[model samples]
Target: MLAKIEELLEQAKLAIDSATSVEVLYEAKVKFLGKQGSFSHLLKEMGKLTPDDRKTIGKRANEVRDILEGKYAVRENLLKDQELNSQLEAQKIDVTLPGVAPERGVLHPLWRVTKEMCEIFSRLGFSVRTGPHIEKDFYNFDALNIPPDHASRDLQDTFYINDGVDRKPGDFSPWLLRTHTSPVQIRSMLTEKPPLRIVSPGGVYRSDSDMSHAPHFHQVEGLLIDQDVSMADLKGTLGFFAREFFGSEVEVRLRPSYFPFVEPGAELDASCPFCKSKGCGMCKGSGWIELGGCGMVHPLVFKQVEMEYPKWNGFAFGMGVDRMAVVKYGVSHIGLLTENDLRFLGQFRP
Candidate 1:
């Protein structure tokens, strides 16, 4: 029995030394120490020995088991260290690399121009006002004295939300994409009294797209109402706006034009900011560039608003914000404003 115990100890020591992984080391432990293993078989045979011999064999067996357990513990720790070393080597990261630079963003050119326009208008005592992109026919047309037979309606090239052709001009369909910000004018008059001076800057829709036009564009409409407002006051205000916006050297002029809401509407122009009245491709070889349209508030327009007709006189004007931006920046195509081309937009960054 002693010889057999010695042989088993040697075998266990060899197995623990040869073990390469924690799983193999655990299997080796089971082989030597389990209930049906060599140590247990030897103990079963010990009951036949004398008491003294039994005690001696028991001490030897305990010593052998302890030594084997210590060996397995060492092997387990060694295997764990090797596994940890392998993982650390595989996941190593370098600390000396330079960082990457992130890209910068900027505002759209259209918005920049819009801000510039609003700033100029604000400086001229015109408070900024806004209205819904959707509008009713009453405020957009009827309240502005623009009737079903108005000629200006033909020129607007409006895009309607409903079947406009199916309804009469004055029929006032439920709603439509506002053709101009001028609807805000009617809204302001309906809600506010005279002595209201404001400029409405917002998006408007039309059924046109070209190098010079976009299906949807921005419009800045100005309105000044008071008991003593005059066309001269309109010219003076626009003259200051043109000079401040274009340059202090630019001149303003009002040419006779017709609009349904104004008894005597006129197209306003400024000396070409690009060529200063000299022929240029930018101004289409014309000495002057038309800025917008303006007129004294017509009696009919006042009456439509139910605002003590003729008791309050004023002037209103509207201009395309896109055209203003193109002229100011010399942009070649109107479509470029909406294309989101980073290279083109980058030029307008502050």
Candidate 2:
């Protein structure tokens, strides 16, 4: 029995050494250690032997089993490593081969327009500023002199957080997602002393949408405050911006418009670049494009900021970057801008 145990151990060692792969090594291990294996069969013969002979045979069997198991474990590890190395060598890479090129990403058209607008103002000595998307109604309406009963307060137009419950309809204290970037002007006034010149560029939310309008969009608002600023300064600044943005020959005009924040506001227009003032589909055959709204800051706005009403004056302007991108890129529908179709977006590369 001792000799037979020694033979089994030697066979297990040889099988383990000769195995070329982890799978073969595992099979050999099971053949030796499994339920019907040589080691198991030897243990089953223990009851047929005398007590003294059984003791000797069992001790020798255990010794051989331990040695075989230790050597099998080592060979299994070796075979696993060898198989991995073979795979690596077979799948070797060519270091000198041309590498695959990765697809490049670009800024969205709205973002590009926003950056251009900001850059235009930046060149005119206006630093960039931003404010919270959710804002107190005072900054959005009341501080800007908007009446509480105005149609703009209607649910169909504006996205009010609550029905002003527990506060009332006229309350402007609770925060809301701002409908426009005009609130940034209030934030700039409160945080900084006068002689401020800044352009705010970011996202704004509204409860309105159409072929040309979206519930969420980008805007760039310009604000400049000083002791002696006037409408002429506003006109000159806008004219320079239009020329720089739309080309040297483009014409700009302002028609009287109204806004709650500005006492004497006007809508700015630029001659259509596509038709060169001769009329086209982009300008709706009018040869001019409405760019944005601008006006002299109302005195009440100054009063809200405690800046001594009438002592300081400024101009504010809000322009839809989405609209500007449409005019610049000849985009027919605003939905095309928000859609994540790579084919449409890829056209605006850089």
Q: Which number leads on TM-score? A: 2
Candidate 2 residue spans exceeding 4 A from truth: 1-98, 163-173
Q: How much lDDT does candidate 1 score? A: 0.84
| Deviation of model 2 at 213, angstroms | 1.7
TM-score of each: 0.70, 0.72
Clashes of each: 0, 0
Instruction: List, residue by residue over 1-350, the lDDT tens digit for candidate 1.
Output: 78899999999999889998888888888888878877788889999989998899889989998998898888999999998998999998777878686877887877777787879988978888899988887888787887867654444566556654586545535467888898899889889977888999989987777666788989889999998878899999999888888899999999999877776899999889888888798778987988889999888877888888677889999988888888888898878878889889989868
Lowest summed-lDDT stretch of 10 residues in model 2?
A: 164-173
Residue 261 miss distance in model 1 (angstroms) = 1.2
lDDT of 2 at 97: 100
Clashing pairs in 2: none
Q: Over the stretch 13-125, how does candidate 2's per-residue lDDT look in tens digits?
A: 88888988888888888899878887898789889999999988988888888888899888888878888899999999999999999999999888889999999899999
